[model samples]
Target: MRLSNKLSHALSCAALTLAATPALADTVWLKNGDRLTGTIKVFDGGKLVVETSYGGTIPVDWKQVKTLESDRELMVKQDEFTGERAKSLKAAEDGKVTLINGEAPKTVELASIEQIIKPKPILEDLVWKGNVDVGLDYKRAETDTDDYDVDFKTTARHGAWRHNAEGGYNRESQDEVTTTNNWNAEYALDRFLDEHWFWQGRVSYTRDHIEDVSSQRTIGTGPGYQFWDDELGAFSLATLVNQNDYEYKDGGSDNFYSLGLKWDYNRYLVGKTFELFSNGELGKPIGGDSEYELDAEAGLRYKVTDWASLNMKAEKNIVSGAKDGEIDETRYSVGFGVGW
Candidate 1:
């Protein structure tokens, strides 16, 4: 009896292990009758992402998918409806899925499916994400040039409010002669009114060690639109009327009113291993010596791991009507950084 009890306990343990494993629980069927087994990550832009143990993360063509099923609870959106919460999904007739919602199960055609995603839990109310990058160069033979650049950007969101801040420092010298020295910082606050619209208030300050311009300050506020924010990417645009103040080293100063446009955009591709982004603000002065100004950056990040990435960027700063003349500078940098 003792031996029989031990054998029964071993068999029970094996069954429990198999049940706990993620193997082949989620499924996708194609029009050709071929089927794939994996956990569904997301369905966006005509591609269905699935995470498989053997194949890693794979993107399947949405058009060729006949039906799909998953034991995971998900929110499915279709037509003009907000969305539907389902305890699970079951493959139904060809090109359809049955969403098991308690006692009432609903069938939806694959064509009518607009989006499929796991619902965000309330615990995600306070979330933070950001990254830092640096660039350094030195030369010993040609006049002993030394260059340094560092920049950081971060975003925090709580409920309907979002905060963004970015700052950078740059200095270059050749043979103890300072050619460039400047640092700038900016902060912006966004109060989302709804899913798409928001109000933004921002302020920025800059200090320069150059001969002509010594400092700059700006304050602005306006309305904006968030086109989308999701696992794939995010994009937003805003227009602001700004109050600007500038001071030069020779005790010269100027203040002006300006209108500016700002845009922030980013996109992730290929299972989130690659990212493309561009963000900037451009403005035209109304009643001052400055004509137009621009500050922008565009970049690409190749993720080497979840927290580390290799990056390349091009940054541009142009002040068309500075007291000294048109001030234009462009820089290219390659660096590695960590993000979360």
Candidate 2:
């Protein structure tokens, strides 16, 4: 009879332990007024172990805890660009709508929140696009010059493969039409090596022409490095060597060298960019002494909708010796495009 009584007592204790386990998994309010909801794995020696549902173990201090409760939900925030979600606990007891998947605790003003609902993480593929532009320009020097240009660009990306193609045509007053074309293709295999460093390689080609003045062509390939990666922004550096051919007026042929930096700044109001150029040149002039050129440009892009945008760019030409001096080129156009 004593043996049976002992077995019954042991079974009763096991049942009570199971029932109390979930109760200990309740919400914990810290002395600093922070709130957390998870299964408490340890609560001894003024410390605690919380097994969060998002699959992580957190250790916290008992002194930092104010009051422990059992009926509140944990909230978090998310990144708008990367669609990455992160969780954080509440810091104080206030009537505020909390983001359940954000990086930090956010006090969503009652007036700002149109509605309070469960937030879900956004999962979507990267977007790809294609565009075209047609415009007219008036050019006059010692002679009357009138020109019209039609440009088209197409871009496609799937996984690591990306391709860009551009072509343009310009007609001069002398009934001479010049055609220009350029293309770039790159394959990016991104490796998340501890979240901070990456390496990439790209190949590109360019061909440009101007009636009788000059015609230029180039082909290059190189590797690049990325140092920072976050929602705020990132920086990268690359070096490339191109085989360039320049044919000038008066039947003169010369070769030029190309080298420059590619900077990406997506932090402030400016959107996105791509710049490739050479400032220093080693080429003979047709009639004058050899000259140097400084070529740079800034472009602004505004997205009016998912299918359209406006692009405006200003280019500068600062040459050591040239007729009519340096000139600024401005182009503005509204275009409609589609992407996947």
- What's the lDDT for all of these models? 0.85, 0.41
**Predicted candidate 2 versus true structure: per-residue lDDT over 1-340, tens digit per residue:** 9999999999999999898775435566655656787764433223455667754546565446554432233222121123222143333343333443444545453223211112233323232344554445565665554555455555442223334454544444543433322222222233222233334333333233432324455544445455542222334454444444555544765555555343333221322222221111122233433264443334444545434545544434233443323222333433333221
Backbone clash numbers for all candidates listed: 0, 12
Give the per-residue lDDT of model 1 (tens digit) for 1-340: 9999999999999999999986557999999988889889777556788887778677788899999999998878773226787899999989899999999999988998866777767622345678887778899996898888898899976657899999999899999999989999999999988767899999999998884778889999999999876556789999999999988887888888999999999888877899999999999999778889999999999999878998899999888867654568898888887887
User: Quick one: how many clashes does candidate 1 have?
Assistant: 0
Quality of model 1 by C-alpha lDDT: 0.85
Query: Which parts of model 2 are misplaced by more than 4 Å?
Result: 1-127, 130-213, 227-236, 264-295, 317-340
- Candidate 1 ranges with C-alpha deviation above 4 Å: 1-49, 54-127, 324-326
Prediction 2 TM-score vs. true = 0.40
